[model samples]
Target: MKDISRNDLLTKIQEVEFACLDLNLYLDTHPKDQKALMDFNMLAEEACRLRKIYEMKYGPLTNFGFSLAKYPFNWINDPWPWEYQ
Candidate 1:
């Protein structure tokens, strides 16, 4: 994929987050909805993959640092949510 603008990536991330949240809310009342559960899982996986890509190119937006392998020192470079464009 071409390098996405920070703002675009942030927007996409927010959209995915909202989708996940909405799905969770529905699942709370419809726990036995197998189709919904499968769809939610797929969305969750996509969101995770997008997040990892964004973090790798920019910096961490969550508590978990982008480069877990580089640990300790790398954590210091993690970006706060507000840092995103």
Candidate 2:
């Protein structure tokens, strides 16, 4: 994987999520659109990938079960995910 900065990583996750949201809304109305469904799945995978990278580098994006916890409890660390500029 490329060495992406923290900000860039966050941006990627956000972008993918946005696209997925749009595709999901479309799918809700047009459930038979296989193309849109595929696109949404692909984007969802991308979002997961970017999120894993971010979490591994900095810390868990949230305190929930979405991410595994490391020693010292990274969630208590500085610079929360919403602190992005």
Candidate 3:
């Protein structure tokens, strides 16, 4: 995949996460939904992979993520999710 901007990648991760949560909610009410369950698992995996990529390239997406900062406190230098344009 071509390199995407940090904001775009973040948006993609957020979208996938949302989809996973929504599918999970649907599965809760319809426990026999095989298609929904498959979709949920796929989205969940995608969200996790994207989150790892984002965190590695940038900084921690959450408080408990891995930090690969090469300089002094890059975590503080990076913008909050909402602060992105």
Candidate 4:
């Protein structure tokens, strides 16, 4: 795949994640939905790939050890909840 800006990749990840979640809820109601299950799997894989690409370049996208930290611990480097932009 071609290189994408961090913001673009993040957007893609969010979109895919949202689709996955929505599909998951649908599958919960319709347990025998093969098409939905397949779609969910595809979206899930894409989300993982996008997340790996993002974290590899921009450090962890999450905290509490869900993602690996590099040498300098950059989780605190990003803007905090109350920090101004």
Which candidate ranks first by lDDT, i.e. highest?
A: 2
Write candidate 2's Cα lDDT for 1-72 as tens digits: 568888888888888999999999999999999999989998999888888888878889877787898998
Ranking by TM-score: 2, 4, 3, 1
The superposed Cα distance between candidate 4 and the true structure at residue 38, in angstroms, equals 1.0
Q: List the residue pairs that clash in candidate 3.
A: none
Q: Could you tell me every candidate's TM-score relative to the true structure?
A: 0.78, 0.92, 0.80, 0.86
Q: Is candidate 2 or candidate 4 better by TM-score?
A: 2
Worst 10 residues of 4 by lDDT: 76-85
- What are the candidates' C-alpha RMSDs? 2.7, 1.1, 2.5, 2.8
Candidate 2 local accuracy as lDDT? 0.86
Residue-level lDDT of model 3, residues 1-85, one tens digit each, is 3389988998898899889889889999999999999889888888888987887787777654444455565667647756777
Best by TM-score: 2
* Candidate 1 per-residue lDDT over residues 1-85, each given as its tens digit: 4578877888888898899999999999999999999989999998998788877776666554343433444445635556644
lDDT of each: 0.77, 0.86, 0.79, 0.81
Give the Cα-based TM-score of candidate 3 against the true structure. 0.80
